[model samples]
Target: MILTAIVQTKAGTLVVDLPRDRIDLEMKIRSVGIERLSDQIHIIDDEEKSDISVKLFGESDIGRHLSLLFNENYTLFDVNKTMQFVANSVEDIRDDLEMNIIHDQYDTPAELVGDIERMTDEVGQYTETFYFPLVGNMEDDDDGEQYEVGNRYLRYYEYEIRELLQKEQDLDGTNMKDYFYDDDNAQKKMVSCQWDVVDRNNTLYGKVEFRLREPFTAEEKELVRSWCIGQAADGLGEGLEQRPIETEDGDLYVSMWNSGDDYFMYDEDEMNDYLAQQQGGVMTQ
Candidate 1:
């Protein structure tokens, strides 16, 4: 299984891929070495948060669970500094932890909270540019295989999707990662936004998709969708700070649905089909 570890530090946030057993996992993570190790492992499972980031410790996205080995607790923040990043106030967080533990919220207790500063040497939340990977059996396109996400996309817009992949060849890029960012942004604005070209009803459209990390509620999804639509066009997410987005951009409308989604399932074919049905005076199916 592919183990995705999202390591957040004082420098920058990183999304790493580590696939191995407990022993190997330990050696790989602690290759840099630390002063000491805790008596046990701990985890923060925040299924109730408004975002995809739950664990203050690294997020381990694997099919199953294993004992996590984290070290270097004595050097960093003391009780005061560490509690600053917890749920609410330090007092409230203590109560919350106690209640959550009694309610079976935390998967494992790990070492006691006396050991502050888990995982990496530095720790803090980066509100900007949150990184989370699309997990599960998503196969590479080269093998001509489609998993749950791709198969759903293929059901309706496979024809248009096939054409897009072919166009990707002449496009200059060493790999797919090149096209997965908004180049206009000075800093690397990736994972948050990505776009591609598609042919729909003979008109070229930008197939744009947005990501809403997790605890995906209806409001959060719409907020991200609207924001991406505003940016879908040529640097004008609102459609004209530099360019008009949505209708003006190749895409008719901006949209997003990840987290509890199969990547995204909408495509040009579905749009055309809806338009056709509307034109026929039949309600868009």
Candidate 2:
């Protein structure tokens, strides 16, 4: 017989796997204080925001009783207390009752929040560059283009999530402490912003960057570039950047302000050329 228990907290989730054979089931049941633990489960999550749940396997009678706690939430404090109860209950059950932790999901809020802050900082830097040239050229109206209230862009920020593994700890197999830890294996990145001119019907652009700790290979760089392009397309609901330059890896880095004037000028020239050809060398505004 096997029993599965899961405890979820604001920080993360923990899964414990318990396996016991039929021969020792009766003896283990009597030794392990399962009844005492079940009675105490109610005391957890008094605040009404419990984050824990459990599942029991084996005979129908025990499984039915355990099902009552399934999908229910419990406070972290109560969850910890329940785990201690289980640990102590199974201490004398012997090797016949095998319990192994199969899954653990943990998050480092401080590190994750820090990553967000850094991404925001990068966005700020980009915005500063965006307004710098426009501020300088505010008075210059040599081209037909003019900046109005609707020329600014909108910005969105969100976390890019992926499967994260927790770090290994120096604890025994039976200890639940190993199941909960402030560790992360995968890098956390974000698709920071999608830029579209407020009034113009231009292609939507997106920006994705990795604050990589290790240097990537040539192929890896290309992969990151492709990922950035795809993220932008998904966010914007349009295709890739209209005027992508030829580059070794890919022209993934986007300088919105630098290209703002150029795209407008290109559009104007294309329109002018089309009109000239249509009029047989005579152009009309």
Candidate 3:
């Protein structure tokens, strides 16, 4: 049940295949220094997608940080745990366990020395300062680290993201970016900043869709869009997809207080069926 893939090492000479089953979970946890057992845990899963991840919920006895991602959440655990609550007595299952454990360690000063390389663990920066232009990460900075800096509003991209944070407050892109980029507490009217807008997940592959209050040139429109999303994400702390979706009624707008999902869908048949159902529903109505 391991995620099948070839992983290249830091040295180009070494190419290692991912391990599905190497050791037992007990041994795995022990390897990561989970000795005292006061480790708090939180799990995020999408049952439909067969995805599950167990992460450190709070400070652990082992001062380090850890999280586990399984290819098939139920299958891996089911094979290992079988019917046990504790899952300590698992055998061949452990040797065949398919998952990845990311182990981050700290130095005497508590700054991360580095992530101890485990099976398929990706090396990471000790701390990351990310700007949320459209979505403020709701996930806790339980690593005792503030990886992402936020502003005020957050939405998945409801027009309200614009109406509420922009129209209501009169804050524009220049001000919004300045406010977010500044990690200081000072009396300030407006700060200057660059136009750095990222899609959800803080990546370049993000789509933002909307109409503006007054018409503007292309450059002006770009700044307005960035400000609109930045303001919404800084304020709301959460948001949905900002990509343009056209409907018979009009451009769909939502509130920051809601949630939705956008799959990287490749199921053409399924999508067609869904669209057909929606069309039927509309016609029926």
Candidate 4:
């Protein structure tokens, strides 16, 4: 199913296409801060149609980098520009995938690439980074490739820890973005990250409740709030509805060491216990 919407503003005209069947057109209309067009927008049934006309508008330099206001502090520059950045990010993902495939072992590079593509099939927002500690002093070869013989850490063995997670995503019906990266090396532990994408599939909306651990830093508090915006972006595309929750508890935080539907809170005692359980359970490093 293809849904097309024609949008016009003081700057210019924009033609948008949603290739998904289950699309909330009303939500999308409101996302552009143009709720009045909700009723005026039209969608054509093009399932049987072989070809469709797509109108392309000329780029306007006026608001090419304009700040799209989605509530306060939840601003996006431009979708077209952002997509370019996302394209660049794909190269980075490929580079990391190549590095891991060359240094770590499991299957062919094609298989790993296919797995990554499948994992990131959705257009939702998420980012991940891999880490492997350097066990010995590193030296570059003639081809400029860094290699170490004796050290397991220098050989990029940390990625092997995620073999179970890869299987879970491939067979256990787990969401790829939700897969946790576990590492035994303390130096490599701090390099994992997963951003929560707010979608109808995961977000609790206003039902979200915060249970934060105490003695947290200001940075940790901000990180929790940042994820909220990210979750909104995942759900509402480029728009956001920032609703700050007042918590009497201490600062909120997110850790890469754990995995859950809700990742924006801290509990020192409970977290240590949860980590122990996770380590002891299925996902071990």
On lDDT, the leading prediction is 1
Range of the 10 consecutive residues with the lowest summed lDDT in candidate 3? 112-121
lDDT of each: 0.31, 0.29, 0.27, 0.29
lDDT of 4 by residue, 1-285 (tens): 122335554434445643211134445545656544332332222323212212222233212211111112111112222222222223325555435434543233234434455434332232222211111222343343433233333123223323322332233122222322221222122212232211111111111222211222445434433553344334212221111111232111111222345443323334335445645643222
Residue-level error in angstroms, candidate 1, position 88:
29
How well does candidate 4 score on lDDT at residue 245?
15
Clashes (backbone N, CA, C under 3 Å), per candidate, total 6, 4, 13, 3
- Write model 1 residue lDDT over 109-183, tens digit each, in one string: 233232221211112222122111121123344563524333233334434443443333212212222333433
lDDT of 3 by residue, 111-200 (tens): 211111121122111111122213333323344232221332222433434444333222111222234432222112111212223333
Model 1 clash number: 6
- In model 4, which range of ten residues has the least summed lDDT? 67-76
Candidates in descending TM-score order: 2, 1, 4, 3
How many Å off is the CA of 110 in candidate 2? 5.2
Better of 1 and 4 by lDDT: 1
Error of 1 at 219 (Å): 0.8
Clash list (residue pairs), candidate 1: 230-237, 231-237, 239-243, 239-244, 239-245, 240-243
